[model samples]
Target: MDAPALDLPFDAEAMLPGLRRWVECESPTFDAVAVGRMMEVAARDLALMGARIETVPGRMGYGPCVRASFPHPRAGAEPGVLVMGHLDTVHPTGTLPALPWRREGDRLYGPGVYDMKGGNWIAVEAIRQLQRAGVATKRPVTVLLTSDEEVGSPSTRDLIEAEAARHAVVLVPEPARPDGGVVTGRYAIARFNLRATGRPSHAGARLADGRSAIREMCRQVVAIEAMTTDAATYSVGVIRGGQWVNCVATHCDAESLSMAKRQADLDEAVERMLALRSATDGVSLEVQRGVTRPVWEPDGKVMALYETARGIARSIGFDITSQSSGGGSDGNFTGAMGIPTLDGLGVQGAGGHTLEEHLLVSSLVPRAKLMAGLLQVA
Candidate 1:
């Protein structure tokens, strides 16, 4: 098996220090300065792989993006492969002190390790190994590490899509499924905010004159809940209204979200939600559609890409399987753009977006090898 499996040139244990360095950096999505620091460190590491690295200013008001271009050995015929990941984590600042980066037995625990920072290193290590082996990539490889993915990729969607459009394939090293599965399709997500407006009046003193926005929202909530069915699921996460028990609420707001397995389901669900109007005579409803991650539905070409990757894994003496994700990634944008994309190609880990997040130390070498092999051929 040692000979059959793609042997890593460098000891996998050596990779842990870099992982720790990244985790300790604490690059949360909301902190631009912190995320920028993380990107700066990543740019240096990516530059070591003989890539011409550049920092793209964050146009979406997030942190700057790090793009590393590895020139192909051969002149460009078709667009090369795009290796993409995000630098942002759901964890806020000061999380490292609380969770801390430490290795116990076979697990590395810290913020951002499992969700994505680990994935970033895996991709970087793959390229590092490739460069060390003197193997020139057949196609140019561009590694784009965006700073705002955990918060919905507001600044990087266009960048990811534009880059993927030119590439033959988009390789996203998002964290692997807890069971070591990769991802082929991801659900479309649309965040929504519904606000109800009404006139305020003293509840007890002028009960007949009051039209409660909270009551209007309550009626609309029934319709919102009903919108969840087999194909699409919807839920309201937050609700705020009313000043006191004696006063009718002039305003009510609800933060809701919907996820669909298909595009039609997403569109239909959004339309229905937006159609929700005032249930009370004097109340009015307003719907605002927030960040939307389009569905990454697997088509024939993408399936073929998956099959190719499955074969690559087989060559390395491992069985690779892919699953569909309810959550979305930058892969969604590329997949929606009809680019051949593969995701969850990063570290094998669980407990993403939690203080318990960890990456399997044993998975580092094998997953990195898989990425290297894919880069060599794809």
Candidate 2:
């Protein structure tokens, strides 16, 4: 397939070198040091673009967030565009060796490539292209590269909301939809911590004397999985318990996540999940709530922004559609807060949060042009 005739100067081949650097950085969310390194790499690129950079120190043991404000005629005057993205990925530090950065046909494979690093780079490149051509944007542009999004924006939720409130619209460069669509709405997501406690005893000598917390937790997991329905789904992805095989486990813990199409349904799911009790007589269960992303149902303002982006896509020769994605992103915060937010404005790709993660090489230029056009007009 050939790219549509667009006037933008963005070139996919030209973007590869820098994009490779970003993908190779391997900034996983849980590793603050790795994430910090990724921030530095992005900072250097933003600085080279003549953007005024601010490094907001990371709180709660996460890495710092990079906020780059591009020079504009209406600099810091009114609410402008906030292009938000996360530099972190779900892959751990050693993932690079297994999923090494390489190109296969039209795909660029690497750790965090399709999940977000590629999108973050695209945001910067959009600004770079505009600056290179001396094209002035209608509003000020601020790119906020956050450290956490894969594990929920725990350290950056307040920052994302605060910065977004000061902007007229938020554009998130999460991986684009398989159908080449942008995101206008996102589902509500809730995280939970579950703990089970029970009496411990020697497994070999007194198995019946012990009340195993792991056993109770196993029951809880089954029950939690059974709670899934068409409106909302529940999952327990992480679980830890037991010190040794010779002793009955005294305590067990599990992490859960739930997503819903609507806020009300999510609230109901949350209540139900929290209400769980230990099935065994001597065991006790506890459920603690974690960070949440409110349901971002698209409103008139959001739809209007989508209309503008759709028109821009048409000008570039290919039409674009908008979607309400099941996954969550920073757009959930901004869109839910009534700010006009557009998401999935990144490279076309598939296989996010997996070893097979990759992005279409052909999507770089068009997506960058789309981002640049939005920076100019939206």
Candidate 3:
């Protein structure tokens, strides 16, 4: 495999300022006000590259999603490529005080630097490079930055899928693997909240008369845990019950996280959950199941996209490999829409969803170059 020719004139200095501006803006998902401000910034930056930008408002605490695009200069070339990322961070307001970004040698440390802000900036820089170099492609490019990706994209999945269906390719800038590989497939996730209610009685006076909802909850937990198999995994992440140590418990609830490789596996898990019956007679159970996101299966289109990405990476003096991850991202939605999607194109780093999250500063230029090349090819 030969390296792709790099024709774009990359401006590292220009990208630095844009990255700083984006990172400084607090775009936490739960903070609609702050996220709105961040979207404004993104819109402003994107406008400079002649992208037509639009903001879609979200409900309640959810922030707005920004959709921006730069059409191909030539008409009727090919279906455009859609670059997907999120503007919101998991950190809430005041978290910046604790996760202040620092430059230690070649690493950049901050709350959302590696998790995605850095990747977002890279996408912007890549577009800038393409515009500056006057690279003409038959395919146009659209960037979709949402506000609720970290929290499972509950409100943005529909928008993502709809947009993805209109494109020939979807590029996700989620943080790449620590070893700098792309993510081809990701596991599917299903979350359930189970509540059991039973009659309450005095523990000392009428122990037999009162049904134990807590005990029934334990039985359900065991049954759910038993569903975990080689291809699927389940966890009882949270459990709550009992008013006091002495009082008879009348209510109980448990939250479980389930992961599956296929739809059949997920169906099996859900069926098992639905089959659960109260251990004690007269006790009632209620279950609320929610699917946070669907799995990104590795199909023919995805495999072809990976090959293109690998060729582009090699063109930039790097070798690229891809693997299926148990983790999910916005790419899952795009892939489910039958679009060829490639993810994990951001700077290499580790420790997402933690205080130690960081990015390797050296990766910025090469990754941006790779993206610029991809845009040219698209």
Candidate 4:
């Protein structure tokens, strides 16, 4: 039997104005006020689409989260679809001057434009298009916009899990892969904070009397990175030490991250990282565990959901492939819980978390139509 026809006039050019507004609002993860403002903008848009808007208060020093629910004829009879995306970005608030919004060929460049404000906007626009066509979906839809995804969703993990528990399926519009693919599975990730303490003394006059914490930290960094294997990898991205050049450093701090393809491998990697000790005689090393995202290996149900999306994309004149990613997103929580999840359903471009972040302008309409189709059936 032929499926019901859906007539949606999704215009890429018409989408630019709304997307540009979202991209220009800089909401870095650490800045709570900025994130709240971004939420206001999204709340208004969601309200315009006849969704019940709820602004959940932020906890743990983060900003608020916006939950928008669309009413349905069978609202409580079954679980609904959860469309997830994060509003917080990695770039700071003052990044507009250097990386302002501009159109060059097909790429639309701006802060948070591609790495995910564009994707979130696209999802909302999809629902609006469906409403304009007067099409009712099989299930109800809810949109959850979070505040802290760039730093592993520390403040929002519990809320994300709680929300996902009530949903039948999850769709994460994080950035689409460079080849316009989707993500079925994501690797496990763990973060650690490292501190080294030692005695302080003059560098020139009493060099032997003092133990340099900076030197000890450097040694530990090298050893930690050397622990990488075929299944796991480690990197120390941030380091700070030494108040003065002439005096031996008393303390040094660093942050490191680990990633693995499997849960067992990541567990082993975490154990190895926590077991690190100071090789220096008078220096003490401390390792504290931080936020972690467990591995989300796709199951049969996840694959089935992907197949549905693939069929929808095929009808839209574009085909999408699925892959496993090393990066972590909110989908990790839901997918790990054995729920059917489809991720990486976002805008197409490149340079996330960098100055060249952008999305392809030509991809807007097709991707929006794809998302609209999914909302209609899946």
**lDDT by residue (tens digit), candidate 3, 1-378:** 223327566655556677877777877888988999999999998988888889899875788889997866652365688889998887777777787777788777777888799998998888887677666644788899999887678788888888888788888889988789988888887788899998898898888888888999998888888878988888787899999766678999998878888867877777777677787896898888865667778898789888888888887789888988777789888787678888998878776777777888888887888777777775
Q: lDDT by residue for model 4 over 1-378, one digit each (tens)?
A: 014323588888889999888888889999999999999999999998899999999989999999999989888789999999999999999999999999999999999998899999889989998888788787899999999999999999999999999999999988898899999999999999999999999999999999999999999999999989898999999999999999999999999999999999999999999999999999999999999999999999999888988888888788999999988999999999998999999999999999999999987887787788888888
Clashing pairs in 2: none
| Candidate 4 Cα RMSD (Å) | 1.4
- Which candidate number has the best lDDT? 4
Q: lDDT per model, in order?
A: 0.85, 0.90, 0.82, 0.92
Better of 2 and 3 by TM-score: 2
Model 1, span 1-378: residue lDDT tens: 123226658567889888888888888988899999999999988787678989998865689998898867653676899999998898999887878988889988999898888888988888888777677665789999998888678888888887788889889999887777789999999988899999989988998888899998988877788878999999887799987999899999998889999889999988987777776788889999988998888899888878877887887768788888988898889988898899999898788888889999888888888888778777
Winner of 3 and 4 under lDDT: 4
Q: Stretches of candidate 4 above 4 Å error?
A: 1-6
In model 1, pairs of residues that clash are: none
Candidate 3, lDDT over the whole model? 0.82
TM-score of each model, paired residue for residue: 0.89, 0.97, 0.86, 0.97
Candidate 2 local lDDT, 118-153, one digit each (tens): 888888888887787777777899999999888889
Arranged by TM-score with the best first, the candidates are 2, 4, 1, 3
lDDT of 1 at 371: 88
Q: Ten consecutive residues with minimal summed lDDT in candidate 2?
A: 1-10
